[model samples]
Target: MGWLVGVVAVVALLGFYLTFTAKRVDRLHARAASAGRALDAQLVRRAATSAVLAEEHGEPDLYAAARGALDARVEDREAAENDLTRLLRKQELDSSEASDVAVIAASRRVALARQVHTDFVRDALAVRSRPLVRALRMTRRHGAPAYFDIDDPTLPSVTQVTSRATRD
Candidate 1:
């Protein structure tokens, strides 16, 4: 009887542990999804802002580039975003101080959003990859979590842009 009781207790504890792990994985997946949506919104904002800035600056080439990328499909979005960032970094800002400041702020937001998204993705992946989680198939419904791979640009900080504007 004592041996039977010990066996039941062990089984109960294992069940509880598995349940806890499953719940944790679910929460992480939810967090990743929410972060992804926020990141997408920020990317759209960055692209739209860049397009407007390009048009306002009277750079037809830059405007066309930005517009093309802004309208690209999801499969090509990473490349388009990278292209847009590369162009923005290379092009000289011929606008007023206020305009330059606005662009810098938008770019900074994109950088921050990307960082947040990446962090959430990493968390989800870490949880999903745990030995117990995998053995018990905690992520079976969701399959495997994938990271958003992108060559995120290092845009100028607000201070750098402001100082350059002042110097110029």
Candidate 2:
């Protein structure tokens, strides 16, 4: 009788633990998805700001890169964004111009959003890779989170431009 009771208790505890782990995985996946959406929004804002700057400066290459990033399909997005960043880095913009200042600010926001999205995805992947999670298929319903690999969107000149703008 005692052995039977012990067996039942053990099973009950295991069930509770599995339930807790599954819920945690669900929450992490949800957070990762939310972060991805925020990152996308930041990227769009940065591209739009870049497009405006490109038009104002009469830069065709910059304008094309920015537009490509904004219109890119999912598979082509990273490349387009990388091209836009490369073009942005090559340009010298007057810090005093409102459009230029907006571009710098947008780039900074993209950097921050990308970092946040990366962290969430990492966490979700870690939890989803646990032995118990895989064995029980806890993440079977959730799609695996993918990291967005792109060039660092923040320009090195941002600090200099920002400081100069602030001093003016």
Candidate 3:
């Protein structure tokens, strides 16, 4: 009788642990998804700001790249964003201009958002990769999280302009 009670207690504890782990996995996945959406929004904002700057500065190449990023399909998005970043890097943006300032601000936001998205995805992937979680298929319902690999969206102009302003 004692042995039977011990077995039941062990099984109950196992069940509780599995339930807790599964719930944790769910929460992490949700957070990752939210972060992805935020990152997408920031990327879009950056592209839009770049497009405006390109228009005002009469830069056809920059405008095209920005538009391409805004219109890119999911599979092509990273490349499109990279192209935009490259073009932005080549331009000598005047921080005094309102449009230029907006572009710089947007770029900063993109960098921050990307970092947050990367962290959340890393955490979710880590939890999902646990041996017991995999064996029990805790993440079966959610697709594996993927990192959005893009060029460093941080613009050199941003740092330079910020330092210049601070010194003034």
Candidate 4:
């Protein structure tokens, strides 16, 4: 009777462990999805703000090109965004309201949001790739998660230093 009770206890403990792991994997996947959406929103904000700045302060050609790219379809969005970046790099625009503070803040938000999304994706991937999860087909229901990649400018070193100093 003692041996039988021990066996039953071990089985119950194993079952609980498996259930907990499965729930954790599901939570991670959900977190990754949420982060991805946030990143997408930030990206859109960056592009729209850039377009506005380009129109207000950039040359006419730059404004036209940027406006077109901002309105581009989803299939061509990546390339259009890359082109917008290149155009901005080629010109020195006047500091209108659009470019003075708004664009700078938008760019910074995009960089931070991208980093957050990437971290969440890594967490989900780590959980989904675990040996037990893989063997048990635990993540098969949700399919695979993907990482978002985009080219955006980093915040200036001066801005970074000032922010750190203020925090301290």
Candidate that would win on lDDT: 3
lDDT of 4 by residue, 89-164 (tens): 5655334444746666776787788888889899889988889999998898775777766676443322223466
lDDT per residue (tens digit) for residues 1-168 in model 1: 999999999999999998888998998888888888887787777777777877777877667767777788988888887888888887665444566666667777778877888888899999987898888888987755556676665566434345666778
Q: TM-score for all predictions?
A: 0.81, 0.88, 0.88, 0.77
Model 3: how far residue 14 lies from native, Å = 1.6
**Looking at candidate 3, what is the lDDT of residue 110?**
94
What is the C-alpha local distance difference test score of each model? 0.77, 0.91, 0.92, 0.73
**Best by the TM-score measure:** 3
When superposed on Cα atoms, how far off is each prediction in RMSD? 3.8, 3.9, 3.8, 6.6
Prediction 4 global C-alpha lDDT: 0.73
User: How well does candidate 4 score on lDDT at residue 8?
Assistant: 98
| lDDT-better candidate, 3 vs 4 | 3
TM-score of 1: 0.81
Error of 2 at 12 (Å): 3.1
Candidate 4, residue 51: how far the Cα is off, in Å:
1.3
lDDT-wise, the better of 1 and 2 is 2
Which clashing pairs does model 4 show?
none
Higher-ranked by lDDT: 2 or 3: 3
What candidate 1 gets wrong by more than 4 Å, as runs, is 1-5, 94-96, 157-168
